[model samples]
Target: MDVPAGVLGRLRGICLGLPEAYEEVAWVGVRWRVRTRTFAHVLTVEGGRPAAFARAAGTEGPCTILTFRSEGPELDVLRRSGPPFFGPPWGPEVVGMVLGPNIDWNEVAELITESFCARAPMTLTRQVERPPG
Candidate 1:
């Protein structure tokens, strides 16, 4: 199964909107990168092809997975959120989210923005307008 067009489109809008961010075909799916650093990646998992991701998602069936960067309190929160959220077995700061009809696009936008900032250089990150905390 492939990533749904609407979900991919929404991700494109969020990820590409970042300063100097670019999209490319990843090993299994699509990834958005800032320079050489990938900040966001979306792919479909099926038949436990990617063992780690399949296990983390707790399913062998087809499912869309989005992996992105996170840190500090946010990372901790997402890691403990369970279900739709899981800690991908890669970078310590990398977080994986399961995409479905119930996903909150606004939250995905926010997470993608944060991931961009984490991977982008200071000069580029400074140009992004983030919500006041």
Candidate 2:
């Protein structure tokens, strides 16, 4: 299904709030990047691709999900948390969660920030963590 405008809008607000974050669409989905490194993206489970994730994220049809660059343990926590959140088909260090009404916006924002910090360069990370006086 079409990604709700509000869902993407809110996510954009959160991710782009970080240092040097930008958005782009590619083969995978809408990726939020720090320079050239992707810290997060949306997942679209197209037919015949990502079979396992399509089943897990309930995206067998047209659906959009917010995926993040995170650690394996964190992904496992999200997997156990249930609906609107799960691990992607590939990448043990990646986590994805369906963007839907059930999600708490604040939590999503926090997750996005954490994901950005995880992938952003140390230079940018330091700036975000400690702005110039």
TM-score of each: 0.95, 0.78
lDDT of 1 by residue, 41-128 (tens): 9988899967788987787858899999998899999988997998876778999999977998988988999989988999998999
Range of the 10 consecutive residues with the lowest summed lDDT in candidate 1: 49-58
Which residue pairs show backbone clashes in model 1?
A: none
State candidate 2's TM-score. 0.78
Question: Highest lDDT: which candidate?
Answer: 1
Model 2 stretches with alpha carbons more than 4 Å out: 43-53, 129-133
lDDT of each: 0.89, 0.74
